[model samples]
Target: MSRFALFLALPLLFHVGCGAESGDEDVDPLAGIQIIGDDLSDIPLRGASAAQVARFKEGDRLFDFVFRERDGLGPLYIRASCAGCHEGAARGPGAVQKMVLVEADGVTPAADQAALPYGNTMRPYGVGGATTLVQPEDDLVLKLSQRLGPPVFGRGYMEAVDDAEIERVAAEQAARGDAIRGRINRVVFHSKKNADEAFHRFSEGDENLIGRFGFKARVATLDDFTADAYQGDMGITSPLRPSELPNPDGLTDDAKPGEDVDVETVNAVADYMRLLEIPKRAPADPRGEALFVEADCAACHVPSLRTRADYPIAQLADIDAPVYTDFLLHDLGPDLADGLIDESASSTSWRTAPLIGMRHSTSYLHDGRARTIEQAILLHDGPGSEAAGSVAAFRALPREEREALIDFVRSL
Candidate 1:
């Protein structure tokens, strides 16, 4: 059965227990029908072919698989599986530490870092006793940042958003002459990691690709994201990432190194990620909706977006999904800065985090520093961020209206 149909098949009487609802009380009509992460973030979107459904199920199995040294886990690595950092398929308790040497300006990453611990990521775990944790001796001198694994939901829709549309929004924001000057982070691409392998113009001919996923938009596609997580977070090399890096311990259980996992395994996992459903938006209060617009939070946290009709998924094509993001990189001020340059994204720049599944997240921001949504909202100020006025407007709201706004955001 389709995901939506399964939800409708449930008896309606099950919901109207007590004071939570009246006879017509409205929750997300499709609340409980999930392919993965029941009551959480990893549901599959509606309208999958039987074959697609099978792949999604298989992918989920692979995503949760734990690897050992026999499976070529690591000579040098961090965890053993994909699910380790992103347990429950939600924002990470699996924190990825990034170390970068800051130059004299204190914003750009140092050009030469041969003396530093490792490149960008630090993994502390390895196969048995074969791994030494990557801890820099100059921990104070190097700008260290913790990257929380973001929830993997509704990414297919985000992938379907046309590049022209993203550029168009950037132009519109530029035309507005406001503080929100959002830019794209362009990075490199390889064949195995490009989800649309034959499609990306750069992937076909050039190697330069536009960045879309991750806190700094360092990754471009779900396949790339999966491959990167496999190698960087788990120390497991797949066909997508054919080689392993030298760990701090310089240990290896595998005699020969080229391919640890087959390409089919990586592709299966990517397929599952490709279909993850966007959590349904909580019903909005009219007053909170108006305040959201009034506060100019809508300027950056755009409430709705349309996907092109040509997108692969039938249910997702040409749909007006409320994704609540412009997907461009913006500077959220100095407090949020980490000095880690991700491709074109500067140390101060971070992708405007989509608020689609905000209710499921207990921690907020790239580093998971903000515990409350309100604290996160207040952090959106500084020289380059355009949300300073919006922050002031939000702070001035009446207590009831403020709670209403918070409730509205949580509903997403």
Candidate 2:
């Protein structure tokens, strides 16, 4: 059954009585529906065909494959493989640090990053004896932003969400009196060869496509996301991104010259991400769910959005994906600002976090500063933050009610 159908059927399937025996008699809302566990993120989508499952397995192997210097593993890079940052297909210990050149105020970005050749990414490690650490010039003032790797499971659903749905949500939020307006993050299509792989709404000349991936939502397609990571994070070039980044050694190529991996490899990994399933949610506390909406946290973290019917994957097509994100950029306020500029996303702006796998996540927020879900919520309030009203509402709730809300969110 579809998740939407299952969600709607849950209350009717299990009955709870008023007496103490209700606890014992209550049925499992998700019983036989999903496999709930730590490794759930690693599992493929239900009802995948044999060919799709084979591709998923191939992509899984590639995702975990460690690249060495011979395999084009960088003269300057961050990690050797995708799994280095996204361990277990979820948030891992790895973190990417971005150094933004700023003015005297420390918040305003410098005119440009000409002083820092490697751009904002601080790739401290490298191979081929080009081990000279990248450092800033004496005159340049810099602000460092550390971004922990986000969970990768269920992103295919986000990719499949129709552009119209996002636009509709944006229009709805704009009409609201609350200060919770969201803006679509439009980014240019990077790879010409892969342009045809974009959603059907996009044309041959389309430049600024709706970005649905990354913390800044700067990437539009899952294939591009995979190709970008292979090159940017690992310095392994593919057909999509064939050029090597500038390094201290001034090297223009790696040991494996030309494209390190073929388009097929990139597609395989992208398909794997597309096929990965979200973790099964535990039964939610009804009161807690009600309190979450009461606090207005649902304003930005929308409960669900429907995917496009034409999406190539049958499982993801036209489904109500309960990813709990609007997939639009919003100003989170000054306190959470990182002073880093990414495409159209300002330093203080962040894409609404998807809460599908929150129960399994070890960290919270874009930078992973909050260890606990409650801490994440408490940290939401700041001057000029769109979430200020919601945070205030949450704060005013009684202790039990607050716990209930947090518990409900964690259950996602």
Candidate 3:
């Protein structure tokens, strides 16, 4: 049966007399629905051993390797190392970068608005001894912007998730009607090889596909994203991305041939992330779980997805993914627009982030603008406006209930 149909078939009154029943009388509504202990337990990736751990350490060393002016660091890059942006607090693979704004000349627009000659993510540090000024023939001109962002953690399980499951979640949400539509955000896959010579274009056939990672759902795979970080963040080159950045400006020498970096390093980092377990749930989390569904947060943050058994990792093999998300991009309204549109997503659209391990996350929202969970809840609008309304009802509940809900999120 469809998930929405099953949800509708279940009695909402199950919570009323659930705990009062004797063993022989009514079935516990929370029985099968109870948060599974296995969900919070650490699950390692397949074939991971002490040797793998040693290799991962080697990958960490590679991650910290700094590029010199001769090695080609960045003509346009963000940070010097992945750890620089990804470290601190239970950091996730998805980290945000910050930069300052200077002056620029590009497409003319309204005030409080200007276009960067290249794109967002202004690099604060450039290769040593390079001139900071843009050449006269450059496409556009802009200065730096202020710093913004922090790193997040736990990404390997995210990549291990079967694409079918993400589609299933979206199907389940759509079946619930337009009141809670969750659309998947299609993203570019950097590692995908173009069959045709259309590598630069954005097309469904361009080897690019739906995005499962990033706040905006931009990247396709952990490997692809890590490789991008190697080049864009650290100014390193690999086989998949061989061209070296030019000296001084750190611009890529497009005219030159590319080189290959060690694949083992990239693989180890991906393995480390894939095996990283989700945070454990708190004792009070069950109450929070009940409140999460009752509050309609599950409308978008729908939980309990079954993963494909064929996944490489034995721990994630044929398991139920308790990660709370529909994996869909929805309009967040003008209040949160980044003025950038990717593939199928609009300027105001953002992927519904998985709420797993949300308890460890302090800053909320895509831009990390909301300081607390409550503020994040309040910032919802558009398709998620109903969820925001649900939060309001949740707040009206007894203080203990609110605490339970918070506790549940921490447990995940």
Candidate 4:
């Protein structure tokens, strides 16, 4: 379903009403965004109706539910509940390793026969026992990356963004005369329950659709993302996806097929992630903004994007979303490649992680190796790296300027 993809978000193309209302020279940059608050846990969007708020609570409860062996716990899974790895709705490590084994080249993954179920995700914690699990091969892997789970915040805005906006940004970036050419991950989204039964998916025209969620950007909608997470992460099944994971141990799963949990549980969990609030940020620094732009960081990390005016939430509708991301996939270079070409995203390519609520980030990058953001910044040295120039620019700055720039990023 997902690996620890950093806040996967991109630009919103909405215009603000006016600057006079917020008493600032420019319109409130963060107005209509997540309301500033101390608590960083999942919260409802601004101007949410009473019904919406109630539903948010329901979703939050479902997100917090800890499943047991009887409560549809995985026949062969990694974690039990959504909060098991993502404590407090924030990103964290998983029980079993999210392994994506491939050849030394890392781009061409072997066929399913050579790379069985065990090569993908390592199920260290199975409900039944070791006999009913899928473990990794000892020597088959040339490259294996340990993935962390990303925070599930501000995903609704991402879902509401128009596919045309993503295409427009891709064209604009290509026209800028830069090496940064980010393409959308076009995926075939399936129906809630079955792929062939009923599938009027997220396609703009053809069977393929622009994906916006997950580490590899393989999923297109919040509902599908949630279902995949449930099936893959927790081994829990629902009407949407009613099947146990592959058991390479050649043992019985003991769990029946068809369905494990009801459809309401799936929707509730998805809804919680959808209505989740944006991260809180410190006051904006104009100098930092200028420095961010001057360093060419804004080339890929767009400053502002807009939600559709007719969006569901009053607060999110037509509001200025200052999510600093282009939402397209960019190659971070060989140094940071995962060697796993999932769907359309290349081994070195990753979606532009949204910089909003960056203050709450526990670790940087997909693997959570970079303790500090600076280390993460310095790791961008791949052949297809779009941030190479920006990284150079950041390094060339004076100590104070560099610190100031970093502080500005922290403010986001």
lDDT of each: 0.69, 0.78, 0.54, 0.67
Give lDDT tens digits, candidate 3, residues 1-412.
1212212211321222222113223243222112345452223333556555444444444444444445555544445455444432143223333221233322122244333344344343455444432222344332211222233344655665677888887787778744667687776555533212211233233443668666667776666667767766655666545655444444554222354355556666555555556666556656777788888888777686676676666667677776677667876665565545556676557777687666556677765566777677767854444354665767787988887876676666
Model 4 lDDT per residue over 180-275, tens place: 788888887654453211222343234468777876677777778778888888778776766666676564344544567787777777777777
- Score residue 106 of candidate 4 by CA lDDT: 62
Model 2 C-alpha lDDT per residue in residues 1-412, reported as the tens digit of each score = 1212212211321121112112223353222123445436677788878777677767877887778889988877777767767766788556676777777766678788777776777776677777533456575576766777798999888888998999999999999999999999988778646723544444323577888889989888888888888888888888788888777778888888888999889988998888888877777777998788889888889988999999989999999999889999988887788788677998888998998778668888876778899999988888888989999999999998998898899888
Tens-place lDDT per residue, model 1, 240-268, is: 67667666655533533567777678778
Descending-TM-score candidate ranking: 2, 1, 4, 3
The true-structure Cα RMSD of candidate 1 reads 9.9
TM-scores for every predicted model? 0.84, 0.88, 0.71, 0.83
Which prediction has the highest TM-score against the true structure? 2
Candidate 2's C-alpha runs over 4 A off are 1-39, 131-133, 137-139, 195-205
On TM-score, the stronger of 1 and 3 is: 1
Query: Model 3: number of clashes?
Result: 26
> Where does candidate 3 stray beyond 4 Å?
1-48, 64-71, 92-115, 131-152, 192-208, 244-250, 253-260, 382-386
lDDT of 1: 0.69
Q: For model 2, which pairs clash?
A: none
Predicted structure 4, TM vs. truth? 0.83
Better of 2 and 4 by TM-score: 2
